[model samples]
Target: MKVIRFVLAVALLTTLGAIQALEPAPMERFFIEFKPGTGAIIEAGVRADGGQVHHHFKRADALAVSVTSRLAKRLGSDPNIVTMEPDARRYLAAKQALLTSQPLLQSDPFAEQLVPYGVELVQAPLVWDQGFEGEGITVCIIDTGLYEQHEDIDSSFVLGGHSQDPNSQWFEDGDGHGTHVAGTVSAADNDIGVIGVSPGKASLFVVKIFGEDGLWTYASDLVAAAFTCADHGADIISMSLSGSSGPGPERKAFESLYNEEGILSVAAASNGGNRQRVFPASYDSVISVAAVDESKLVADFSNQNKWVELAAPGVGVWSTVPHVSNSWLFTGGNAYQGEPMEYAPDGVVTGQLADGGMCIAAETPGDWSGMAVLCERGEVTFAEKVATVMAGNGSAAVIYNNEPGALLGTLGEEGGWIVAIGIGQQDGQAALDFLGQEATVQSSAPVPGSSYEPWGGTSMATPHVAGVAALLWSANPAWTNVQIREAMDMTAMDLGEPGRDIAYGYGLVQADAALQYLLAKSTE
Candidate 1:
């Protein structure tokens, strides 16, 4: 029957013949085919250096193929028959050469140089400790779905991972966004990778709202997902996805959650290089998170203006992955597909492969050895181009903004492989400019907290707050959603010029301080 349908469809196309062939009624747009496990590419825009332009095409094969063919034909012209994607790859390779090789965490031994001053770690062996170790708290990660099997995340008591639409298979995230956010909020304190903000034990309800593909999701789905999370007993909903132009059904649904269930919602303020606010974040009931650089300055690309509730460390942070085995072994797994990923130095492999593939040490710079650079998006799209170069790679393949702007994105997997890293506009431009010159590639150890590493955007920052939020909620079961948000705001150490500046928002989230405040208030 399926074969007959295909034959009939082809026959129908043949009948339309000259008209279909000649007029070409917009071939369904072709999209970058992302390999499974990688997160969705939610946004793409212009790059720096004025060397390239980006335009998004809907995920329709006919349209995408038509656009590509046309572009290819256009490239076969005089001033150098060329395609921008390939040019971008070459440009990225050159750029990787100029980067200073250093692991993000290992750089500058001083805490001041690495960890932000705002981060005030709770001293070991507590002083008047509030017992808010998030025992019964439930955080709903409303992005991609969660991976129940991840050792770090506790699914044992996961009330349920529910979805809005019954027909929508999008409840699960093939993309890595939701899981990463979930890890931050409530990954169990299993001796695995990094711990969650709310360490110890808690519940994580995977409330998926985004599809595997598509630039923007229907507001209806978002609304349904939120209501689903609340209905499933979600105490706090941590959302890393964002979009502007709202006040739609989704906003109404979110309002209902706040009014009826008293569900607390947190959203990314967006990574778009503008002050405009994104939805959910812009919504009155939700807490909006902005990005902060190492300098404790608001990331140049992080959305600003009013509507922001707080700020967290958004620059070059790290966390857990669902397929810990695959990611740890550098198997190059794609979180979206939820499959075991294997990475051969090339496409194919020969003898016994090494456990955990070679990782481009964070912050450590090197000449890209014709490999793809993996980067997170933000700052400017050009930052992706730059990281690819500095990583000593041949191509740039960036991930989702991870902040608020656009949470899912795709690599233009047209020519060679792509290298990815999240970058801001200033750094992106600086790297691109460096690519134009003949410069020696720099090298150094990985900087643990600063330098060229995974950082920037609400995506990176959301987990930190989520972890802290978890800790606070755990310590104080009686604290309301509003109360928790208030405590986080009140206890934050101011980083910007006194009071609440946009850069640091109310200040850096101090987990221990918040715990103490909540405990003291409980006594009163």
Candidate 2:
């Protein structure tokens, strides 16, 4: 028995040894910095440590390299190395659809809604009333590539663009987020789908840092893109992406661009809904923007912190989308509870919800034939709720927000339902309050040719401020970036607490007010 116990202990030790031997070494992509003009020595040291240099940022005196954790520690001890940190991943700061067969629509159906609520919210129309449509100013959109062919997008206004990834198509946008952002910046005023804040005035220089896969980019690629935009003579750089990391070479690149080239950098403060800072928005050199809804309330999804310097309309923002049959109309009031949800009969449905309040599972399996059912968000997947309503013979579904603001959602292809749309919490609650009363709710697709949709995010808000920056810069070409930033902050309509607060930094961005202030300052 003693011999057996000894043998078991030995076997356990052997197993532990094997486990330790088989453990994978930590490996990561790191950004390393060295003293000026030490590229050759740095490269040699990296190679000696079994690291491969991916990029040489000569301007910033840094290298983006891949190495094992053990090798990184060895390199960190080198006296010549200044900073060696792991390369961070960045993401596009917008919610996007995963799948759909809708082709890009060719005509402008919602031309009547041309001037988006965002444009009016920021008072850009008033700036346009003064004839400053961001002319002669170049704003570089460093994000997913711009869709140059959209009817609302003016290809002529696109000075040019470049893609860092050779596999990506720079002129086309497979993900609709970048195109939507571009339209908000400067979609033409051709009386088409919708007019941009600076229509036909500012020329957009697309720097395609993000690829088709929802724009997941690396820090090295982002640093490269910034320099590329600067070399192309971008007067202002607008980026709607962020990372949870701190100041790095990418942040330095933005600072150099802003201080040396006099280019302004504007970025989103993130949608993390937390106090933690995100970069490059958190960087001092970049102007960080938060999001506000149409009611002038700060969006619940918007990140708030001391770094938040500005705010803009981001919720329920209607703008141009990639030409596809993806438009829908949503209307609800105390009436029209029995209307049939209208949409393409090919199983594609456009519909409205009954005014009978939040339709949870308890209300399902009832007499809802030909009538769209309204469901409150939560407790199940949107598909599940719709499926429940369908089981009861409902024709369509409307998922309303459980929080304060509106939401952009998907019903997924698997859900056996006809059509659906999302509404804000306030609107949803109001409809629910009118339960069993006379109420009307409706949703339908626009004509085939015009394509427009609503999206929400700090990503959407950044373009509004960037476009306004272009407008202000065009209006006052003599003003420096510092002056422009100051004008924006000083003139913003203060929200929340008396002065600047975390939620609504300096209040909402007022284009007309900023321009007026700048005009007044110029006269001085």
Compared to the true structure, candidate 2 yields what TM-score?
Answer: 0.76
lDDT of 2 at 431: 62
TM-score of each: 0.56, 0.76
The TM-score leader among the candidates is 2
Model 2, 211-266: lDDT tens digits are 77665777877888888888887888999999889537877888898888899998
Q: For model 1, what is the error of residue 511's alpha carbon versus the real structure, in angstroms, after optimal superposition?
A: 2.2
Model 1 scores a TM of: 0.56
- Identify the runs in model 1 with alpha carbons over 4 angstroms from their true place: 1-100, 106-130, 164-172, 213-215, 293-295, 323-456
Model 1 per-residue lDDT at 223: 55
Candidate lDDT scores, in order, read 0.48, 0.75
lDDT comparing candidate 1 with the true structure: 0.48
Please state the error at residue 3 of candidate 1 in Å: 39
